[model samples]
Target: MQHRFEDKIIDTVIYTALLVLSLVSLYPFWNALVISLNSGADTSLGGVTVWPRAFTLDNYQVVLSDPRFFRALFMTVLRTVCGTAASIFFTALLAYGLSRKGTMGRKYYMLAAIFTMYFQGGLIPTYLWLRELGLFNNFWVLFVPWIISVWNMIVFRTFFQGLPEGLEESAKIDGCSFRIVLPLSGPVIATLSLFQAVLFWNEWFASGIYINDESLLPVQNYLMNMINSNSAQEMISQLSGVSGGVGDMVTRTITPKSLQMTALMVVSFPIMLVYPFVQKFFVKGVMVGSLKE
Candidate 1:
């Protein structure tokens, strides 16, 4: 009876803690949605919580209507897809080469690569190098610097090493190239690709620094610039000034913050949608790739 009562108390405490943590984790996203749906003018009045006081779609309308938004969205999507694919291919290729026991100087090459994980040429030198290479202001700059991630390479190598030795020998005997192993690495590839995609999708700092052309900037960079500058406010103010037809409702409902929140949701929603599809692969990959026999 005593042990049962103690276990119940412990379980209650853990459940309570988990509930609080979940709420804390989820509230910000919920609040952003609420603020986005609420009338901007009403949102500005403050104290709006749990639900939108004046529900409106004007925030999304403002975001979707902008030409720049579409351009940024296109750039973001392109970068994520292309970057993720290129990164995984290169990283896995390097991992495959290094995983072979017969490869000469593999240890030295791995040591050098791992060295880069802990040290780097600082920002100024990297910028100068990119500039000299003519990658500055170029779209390739987004993914080129990150094409072969050392950490991801390590994971791939481990996963590759864990494959049955006879499998590779049999494939080779059948006149197959080492590249044949890639078809068997689907889980790790899917997992790492998803990770790389999310990283590219959320990345804004590199784009802000390396990409001077606004058209090349991704959605995150666009959102960052809008939030940091007065552009969102200025655009909303300009829209508000047009006092006829839908303009009056726009003026009454939409504000810079609301638009910002809506854009935030827009930037996050696609990546959020991707997780469900690859989740099983992600879990399996992480478990298998992270462990070695």
Candidate 2:
């Protein structure tokens, strides 16, 4: 009876601690949502609590109504889908091929891949190469240069290596080819696809660096530009509305905090929406791949 009571106490303590931690992790996301729905005036005064003081969709309306928002959103989706598909396809093929111990020059290919990971031609030369390829200002600019990641390749290779060699041998006995062996490896494929999808979705730096055209801007770059422009405009408007000659002070003060909160919400929403569906597959894949067989 005493031991049972002690276990109950321990369970309670653990649950309480986990609840607290979960709240702490979730607080920032909650705060951002509350702030975004809050009136600009309320936000400026830091009047927003857990719930918005003056609930309005004005900010979202303003953001969504902009043509650039739609353009960038579309471009981002395109990049994520196409880039992820191409990345997974090539990575999977290479990983499967490399997993075969008898493949010619496998050691050299692995060494070369690892070497490229540690060393690369600098930015200027890469840019020149892209330009030579006529990918500058092209939509392919987003997907072409990053069609395969070495790290992802290594993960996939390790996963494939973990699979039973007898499975392939059995399939060969049944008149099945490597292509047939692959479709049977669903969990690993799903896992790598999810990883690559997240990579493509989260990528903004590449778009910022490689894409100069406004039409090709990914969601992150678009949101960043929107935040900057909106903050500036809001500052100007607020300053003009205020009677005080302290225009510069007011402009400097209010914009950054509000914009920071808004940008956080904007950038995080897509990932939050996506995570639930992909998360289960992600966990399963990693577990299956991590096993040594």
In model 2, the Cα lDDT at residue 1 comes to 100
Off by over 4 Å in 1: 1-8, 177-179, 241-244
- What lDDT would each prediction earn against the true structure? 0.89, 0.74
| lDDT tens readout by residue for model 2, 50-159 | 99887765555445445666788788789888988899889888988898888999999999999999999889899899889998888999887989889878878887
lDDT against true structure, model 2: 0.74
Pairs with steric clashes in candidate 1? none
Which residues of candidate 2, in runs, are more than 4 Å off?
1-21, 229-267
Residue 4 error, candidate 1, Å? 5.5
Q: Work out the TM-score per prediction.
A: 0.95, 0.81
Candidate 1, residues 119-209, lDDT tens digits: the string is: 9999999889989999888999988898999999999999899999888888998888566788888898889999899999999988889
Please report, as a residue range, the 10-residue window in candidate 2 with the lowest summed lDDT. Answer: 248-257
